[model samples]
Target: MSMEHHPHDVFFRSFFSHPDTMQALLQLLRYKQMVWQKDDGPLTPILPILFYHGPDGRISERFSQLFHPETPEHLRPQQVEFQAILYNLSSVHKDRLTAEKNLEFQAALLSLKYARDNMDLMIDELYRLARTGGTVFLSSKRFALVKLYLLHASSLTYDEIEQKIHTRITDPVIREDIMPSTAQMLKQEGRQEGRQEGRLETVHETVVRMLAEDIALDVIARVTGMTIEQIEAIRQQNDQTDQNQS
Candidate 1:
């Protein structure tokens, strides 16, 4: 969980609260039991970790700490509680980001720390990691992943980052590996957007037909799975269009 801000504890709790998710995960764990067993008896523990880098000043690491203090302590027993380690990256200094002897881990954290304002630093560190094969911060083959990220996150152009990579990396095999990334990204994005637009258009047309039939907003909302407010807004928009045509 690479977060931009500290998340509410319920955010994590809600995930584990789902019985299907827990069951699936536990079943998977049982299938891959670390210890040899005649038959899988009990499921193992699940430790969910959150890597946060949000704008919040304070958020509790423990599950119980997220609750309001004004609530009665006795009532707290009924509430769901679970431990999740939150690594608030914004609060962590680069110098102190040891990352447990993994150079890749360290490099990733360092880049994340300076990603917003200092993209140059992030790119430079990534280049260093690629050169040494010392970090998985940005693998030599996957340069395009971060390139896409920077295009959205920073002012730097694709040409500029590609040139930077070309300057550092001369191997043809690696270059070939990175080339298709942007095209693949575009293809996936185009398909996803096309699907979404089609879906929205279908919904709008359905809403328009239902409005023409003089359906109540509440009934439309229930049948179409849209809020009453949304149905009303669509209704109003349709009315305005009719007035204009007239």
Candidate 2:
């Protein structure tokens, strides 16, 4: 489920090709079937989701679609025992994606669409989504997850990702909690290198402290892996912010 999306050539079947994986999935299906029979109806079916964002590859909902079509009729019917709903994210255009009402789903589509190509565009898209969707959407757990995905998936460092949202995302929940909380989570996962702290304080405060220290933008960028633009923007935001007086 957590992948850059390339190896998933045939959805879960790609990774779950191992006999054990199918067996496990089948076991889950069996349990669900039992639950359905007892509590509800077998009409309820589980559909697996594949969120693919790779640059180049043919994508299709059915695993059978990947196979050559000129085969005999009987050989085709069983090519795939199951299929997943593929979110072919890379191919989706921003304009076409605008119709999506769920900001969370829209974020996934946009983030994956730009994971390899444009960090700035992705950042702008997130900002636009937040601005239009309101604070409730901005502060949702989905937004936080999308933010985390953008931070890790793109070349943009944590600080750079922070810069894109910290000042612009006026919600205290997102700025003060979700942002640093994600950083903390990444540190715990050992995904963030050089994350050391005697007492875990907010990364927002650290950025403010660095700005106040008159640290050069390039130096801050190097230390935090933030771009020079991000550092400068942070300086501008901090200068205008009342947090300095507090």
Candidate 3:
């Protein structure tokens, strides 16, 4: 696909293009390098951090724990005994995550924690956070990025996402700022392709395109004026065609 049509490429380009974002990223890299330097010079004090948000709990904390069970106990002292500070979002309470002082961090953590299982609740929590003084730390652009992240990570349709944002977030300025991103998302979903063709796209073609974009079946049915069963039939046919081609 073209770079212009790729959602990830577009998001990264727009995100990193900002001077503040670029500088913050560079500073983070510099700090990491400084803390974990492995040059000929004396070693820097290293404090590793593992930010984990998977469904499973963390299995190990120290490097030594990875050693073979058959290894001699006497050799234990010779092994590197490195330990990392683990920030396991899966194990953290929602209230604790919400209480985080950094607005960006709180939003990010909540998003990661719930993106797989409960994206709707995550959106509601984000809206609540914004309502309660979180907007001070988030620019419209940053909040838009957060919304884009939701779109990327969640299974919700674009219309559903728009509805959630519209219903939950009442700030007119913030809503206005997010309009451009909404357009970008629509373009990424191939919404503009139909317009550019100078003719209305057929139901079959529209369904195929929406399926490729991973839009929810109900949403596609609503847009295309078809039932969920009809959409599912199209999806199955498309899948069968792909298998035969392969």
Candidate 4:
């Protein structure tokens, strides 16, 4: 696909992109909490717990496409096709077993209510995921994203949640691999000097160069919120750079 119309070009196009979907994700997270509370607040290892929420294909496809892009060019489109299944799996209880059967739903509204009803199981599940090694934290999105937020967002020891789910991230490589803005650019933002127009132009060029080398889009997206189209536009802006490099 051309960069101009690359199918999964937008970040907000993410399955968890919508506010309602985000809320549903949060609700599902509650299951992890309830699981712990029932134990009177201490978590111990149990089963190789696997938390699967919504099964929407769009999300699953995005996760596949965005995560394992080098699989094969022709098969890349398959990633986009499963987005709905991803969302469906990431939210609501379907085939998966939860402590409360009554909290099951076929749609988002019902799922939210169901989750609220069974919040205790969700908490226990979270605590279980945090304390175990083989625990599978498979959501349409990264388990760490929510887990980290919960650490400070709640009074509960979210760190225990990290431990059980095996989410104690030691990704020093992530910090190193990501590009840093220039000293001057960093200084302005730090000092409340605000954005300077020229800085944006320079940053754009830097991001474009990074993208052409087939850098992971997740990394690129973190560095620049520019749509994939915008990043590709940088490639077009500097044809000489494109021709001269990867």
Q: Which lDDT tens digits does candidate 2 get at residues 24-98?
A: 334233333433454332244445554456556545555455567787898986674556665555666679776
Candidate 4 segments exceeding 4 Å error: 1-193, 217-219, 239-241, 244-246
The C-alpha lDDT values of all candidates are 0.48, 0.54, 0.55, 0.35
State the local distance difference test value for candidate 2. Answer: 0.54
Q: Which candidate ranks first by lDDT, i.e. highest?
A: 3
Give the Cα error of residue 72 in candidate 2, in Å. Answer: 11
Residue by residue across 1-246, what tens digits does model 1's lDDT show? 111222221122111111123322332232223222322544334444545533445554455555577879789987646555555667777668744456555554554455556766665665555555632433432343344334444455556756655665566555545445654643433323345554666566655764553333433454345786787688668756765786
Q: What TM-score does structure 4 among the candidates reach?
A: 0.24
Alpha carbon lDDT of residue 211, candidate 2?
50
Per-residue error (Å), model 2, residue 81: 3.1
Q: Order the candidates by lDDT, highest first — what do you get?
A: 3, 2, 1, 4
Question: Which structure among the candidates has the greatest TM-score?
Answer: 3
lDDT of 3: 0.55
lDDT for each residue of candidate 4 in 129-153, tens digit (9 for 90 to 100): 3334222432212342232222222
* Local error of candidate 4 at residue 122 (angstroms): 26
Clash count of each predicted structure: 3, 0, 0, 53
Please give the lDDT score at residue 127 for candidate 3: 63
lDDT of 3 by residue, 117-200 (tens): 786688678767666654464454445445545665567776777787787667876655455556664554444544544323
Our tally of clashes for model 3 stands at: 0
